[model samples]
Target chain A: MSAFVSISLVYLAIYTLSAWSLNLQYGYAGIINFGWIVFQSIGAYVAATTALGSPTSGGFQTYIFGARLGFPLPLIMGTLAGAALALLLGLIILTRRIRPDFQAIIMLVVAIIAAEVVSTNTALFNGANGLSNVPQPFNGVMHLSYNNYQWFFVAFSFALCIIVYFGLEWICRSSWGRALRAMREDDILASHVGINVQALRIVVFVIGGAIAGFSGALLVEFLGTWSPDAWSFVESFVVFVSVYVGGRANNRGAIIGAFLVPVVFGTMPSFLPEFGYPGLSANLEWLVIAALWLTTFYLRPAGILPEGRFIARRTRAREQAPVMPPIAKQGSVA
Target chain B: MNLYIEAIGFGVIAASSIALGAMGFTLQFGLTNVLNVGYGATMSFGAIVAYAAHLTGMSIWLALICGGIATSGLTLLSAKTLLRVYAKRGAALFEMAMVTFGIALIVEYAIASITENNTFSLTIAIEHTHALGPIRFTDVQLALVILAVVVFILLDGFLRLTKVGTALRATAVDPDLARASGIATGRIVTIAWLLSGFLCGLAGGVFTIDILTVNAFTGDSLLSLVIVAALMGTAGSVRGAALAALLLGIATQLVSAAGASGYASAVAYGVLAVVLLARPKSVQGGLVADRVQITV
Candidate 1:
């Protein structure tokens, strides 16, 4: 395969993972977390910091948590870091009697602040230059060929995606999932029904963060580098677009949507004809994405496939019976 | 001590830009009740308009007016054509915000594509600074502060005294109730949009003059700060926004002066976080989670 295809696939895998995490949060849980990319950035930073080893006396950059974690530790650390931050923020913002829109703005502000902090403090991940020279997982031991590595990642990413997909599907299908749906529909009512709404949101938010981190770990290790540029507020929007374009509540829909939007729409721009200037094409690509967002909302407000409404059996019976038909209950049929 | 004074002076300048943006933002938000994320894009358009006018040998003041006019036209047009459509379709508050966000992306990206993502610089001629005690400011900065103060006094007077302003305030309180009271809610909404759009444009132009540079993401970068200021001031309070902007501006300056220049914006953000965490209840009305189905 050509370099372009390989690189595209790498981005696709990472974005797919990110979208999956968003799907779990916004889709199943109905949490309007506008600041979605912070978790991804955290995951990337943690993974990078852990894998780069310690900054020696003559080192060029400085960072905290600088230690060689080898293969699995970096990934674990990344996931945990993302989850921890989410838990902390969730406790503060997700609680309280504030408005959801305000909650979203707060999240966006938090993301902006996170980016600023990371860009400023060099010790926090080597500042804006970011962490590079990151070794691939198992490169020395496996001694894999280039093609082999690509295939290995493909298989590995696919396996993880499958596991996450199924794991999330199970969670969404269980009683816990029903509780979440209840909270999404009406938090106050859910609380009245004995559901600890705040706790539930925090738990799901943390889990979502972990998934985002895990995805970032998989991505950084595959690409062999991570930086502030790797994550931006725009990254959050990309995943969000996919979740909305696909069915919001369906896991399968989320994956399919992610592939279509990010893998296809996002990558296609690179191959387009050169526009007026160098970055013009990239700018037009975003224009197209924005147009797509508007068009989808206008054409398919409920997405390609709308989420199935879960009707209680008791309510289902009443719906079927129809207390009074518009046409006198079809007297002839009776 | 000198550095502290200088920071304070610079903070006031920054606050002037933020105050202009926030007032317009709050008006549109208060009356229409749409978050209007496209606000930043509109500001960018205004800046571009001003830049184009400048290239045509127009005076900066005239160019500023042109920018404000352009922004006002676009805001009213978008509100009538695009926003009305979604709003008519029963799109909720959050969905309206998403729609505006998408529109903003289109506007910003179009500008970027056309401009080739290059930054443009606009120099303001204000070499001389006046010293008062330890604080000093250039003629331009002084002008900005005066303009801000005038705008505040005028807005406050308008809101309190004028019939149109009364109607606007009434609509903000309850659109349905305002309509029932024989007030033309639609006309009031249009007035709010026009005024807000004009101010937004003026803010962008002023910002470019101060920073001496404009880019595609200029408005996007400042948007978070603007929102923070508006929200911290309680969204509907013009005076509150001014006060918040002043606080933010000073805090940012102080941080930069303290040698943590890279984290200056973070300091502003840190203030926002503390406010958010400390009094989440204060922001309850603004935080109501509305279901918005966004797709791309």
Candidate 2:
């Protein structure tokens, strides 16, 4: 029970980090990244490859980049891998004259095709079997017990989550964040207002992709395994449902969503007693998710914790303006 | 050379199935203006329904018919019930696609739950093989090719010759104008649904038989390939879609035959990505975002 609690906390933190990234993209930027899982998978694969120290053809496992550059480095490389992919895909997808639906289709196709390619190419990323026995962070130096290590990792992940949460908050309140929202709401109007819609889109897409990568890197370090099976196109959709349920443009909403969806609902079915068959609960989990997604769309499209209305600072200080603000503001305005 | 020829034969057969689905998709998309991502799910559902019918002692041909009808009904039902409901609420094109994905998940997993998530094998006895020059094929493959040709011809004739087809064409071009011209665009839309659904169902049945397997995820898997074909062909052009299917089918098969079977799907997607990136304007129709919603 304690072990499970520790693992769940780690996953919760990881998922929150992911949700924050996705919120930045879909919630604020209005880019529906249907291929979001691929970014995470990229992070995991790169981290595994970099840390596993290359493949022994006549040995146990095979992968590229055999240099096992201990902790933090692998994680950094993973983040860079993610950013690289995002940069490429964003250029292909965002620097174009296309509809949002078309963008979604393109991303969806990319995700599906990517899975097929990764699974088929046996030499690259060990095909579908995936790379396992990944080195844990500071496993060599830390002489901690297994469960204690788990707790430490959980704390480490949560710390990263707090950092990411603040980062997303900073982006959300930034002028650039306002630009993203403006473009999302009305691209035409945003353009009219002199916002570089395409460039802004690419920037946010890369940022979100980086965050997704970082989250995946953190996740794999704790779990010590990475595989194609871990992330599917459906996994991408599931995250989208999380953001939708939690609320799009809000970091607090992302935390709430990540915890509620993956941490609570996703984990709940596993703990339930056997019902009809072995895979019944697994299938039911997806079915229930779809139902929840549809219900959210119908009942509360803004999700449980909708984006809070922005309050301008000037308007916020107007309550004390009865004596000093009118003349000072008028003088400044003049 | 013989291997190349054999791959071409298989490619043509595969193209027949893909073309059938693409045609139906083009018709629905062009007329209704909704890119129904659930089309693939519906296709799989139809195939499964047909397979069940076959197990229950229906002839293969009869099962095919049953599957087609069931799929059509299901497609119409979804369009009328779910899609229409969402569209009425001012859901944009992208939002509608997302909604259809939700429907697809339910439909696919429902089948998965029923079938116990096991992949069912489908084997129909292959009749005598015939050879002409470097090409060889079973009677069933020849028959499938013929079926595709016949479907296209009949559909072309109906759309070109019939008054209702004219209304469909007109409605596809502009629904409001058709209504102004006193054509009951609503009834035409119902007919369009039936026709497109039938083709979609037929395509599903054909695809399952060609692949010789059926599973809940099969339709979803085939969705991207079918979309690649449908989109490559102009949005509503049947001939264009059929041609695109042939191109994709042949390209993937030839590449697979060249000893890289796994990258074959990727190769096809690579082509789609390139074409889409090159010709973004073709998909958008115009900058105005004009789309005619189907009442049926």
TM-score of chain B of each: 0.93, 0.95
Clashing pairs in 2: A53-A66, A54-A66
- lDDT for model 1, on a 0 to 1 scale? 0.81
Tens-digit lDDT track for model 2 on A69-179?
968898898888888999999997777767667777888879988898888887788888888899898878989999999998988888877787777877788777788
Worst 10 residues of 1 chain B by lDDT: B287-296
Off by over 4 Å in 1: A271-275, A309-334, B285-296
Model 1 agreement with the true structure over A1-334: per-residue lDDT tens digits: 4556766677676777787788878877777788898998888878977898988766888888788987899999999988998899888887776666666677877888888888878877888888888888888799888887777777777777778878887888778988988887777788899999889988999999999988887778887777778777777777888887876877767766777788778876787677676887678778887888788878887778778767656777988996875774555775
Best by TM-score: 2
lDDT of 2 by residue, B1-296 (tens): 88888888889998988898999988888888788888888999988988999999998878988988999999999888888887887777766887888888889888889888899998889869999777887888888899999999999889889998888999988888899999998898888888888888888888888888998877765677788888888777888899999988888899989999888888888888777878876765321133435344
Worst 10 residues of 2 chain B by lDDT: B285-294
Model 2 root mean square deviation, Cα atoms:
3.7
TM-score of chain B as predicted in candidate 2: 0.95
